[model samples]
Target: MYSVVILANGLFPSTEKPLELLSQADKVVCCDGAAAKLLMWGREPDLIVGDMDSLSDSLKKRYSNIIKKCDGQEDNDLSKAFRSCLDYHPSSIHILGATGIREDHTLANVSLLAEYTELLKDIDCTVDIMTDSGVFYSGFESMQSYECKEGAEVSIFAFDNTLKMTCEGLKYQTDHVIFDSLWKASLNMAKSSKFVLKLNHPAKVIVFICND
Candidate 1:
């Protein structure tokens, strides 16, 4: 089992529970300023990878053993951590300090997982981000519509071709629905089932999220 924890820049309140979640990590990798955050929690990262822009002389002196300096111009520490993940191929990677940021940064970081789609698929690894709202998207796959109540919202999006959606326990049911692009899909919470979702492109990565 591969386990890696990455620390990135994000909202303070958003990182409140990171310490708790990160405690279970076998190996922790602080990304740039993320070390500072881990330090605030009184924890030392197993390996801190970044451009060295975020480390301080004081923090470096304290956790010198694990720090692995890298060139920032090439990629962010987050990317470097990903490379490490590929090498180690951990069973799971819990990323902290990655949510509730500038829309561009948040979007970019979230989508960053897409870069490792092949690696992730090969290892069947799941990566989840600990956000203030909730834990989500450790990985992706084709899912079928199931029974759900009305007023329940399911956000569906695709990285490739359309995903076929069908449901049983829903106020509204689609026999063989197709979803593409950045469209929001949800349930009213009025129904549910093992609603089935068939993707025309099963190899594609699909996203399902709950707004409520």
Candidate 2:
């Protein structure tokens, strides 16, 4: 089962999808201000992690037992919440509300997914960011494949300084190419039911399947 983490950003998908995810989550963690959103939706988080700057005083008093404060200013609330989830040793993690509102924050949050993936590599824990537009998966130093309908839109980018990759089953196939810029692999489409990517080093890959 997956552990769900909700960030403070206000870019969650429709209510139905998040509720569905909550229902299936083995544990739910809220990052600081996100607790207020969960409370508004009539759900109590299993744990709340952050610097306590965004959490209201009343809510803090009310949910004191579940609140775990991480006052490190170096990392954002999302990173704090992620560290807290390590205690539960979840099989995988699904992130919500990580985008939207502030474009700078959105990019920063999305960029951190690769670093988080590298941190969890030894434990074999997968991390994904879920948004209304699509889902982003983080992969490192391995071969990975995804199942998607033919003609689906897919994008892959390098998170590190450089990414060495080879792929098949995409509209524009790549054979052992090194990508240095994020835009190098954008706007690709799936050519078959499945697509495969072989990575020579740690990297971040994002696939966007048409919601329709």
Best by TM-score: 2
- Total clashing pairs for each candidate: 32, 0
| Poorest lDDT segment (10 consecutive residues) of candidate 2 | 203-212
Stretches > 4 Å off in candidate 1 = 12-19, 72-74, 86-89, 138-153, 161-183, 186-196, 206-212
Estimate, for each residue in 18-100, the C-alpha lDDT of model 2 and write its tens digit.
55766677888988888888778777789998888888999999989999999877999898888889898888888888888
Reference-based lDDT, each prediction: 0.60, 0.77
Clashing residue pairs found in predicted model 2: none
- TM-score of candidate 2 to 2 decimals: 0.88
lDDT of 1 at 159: 51
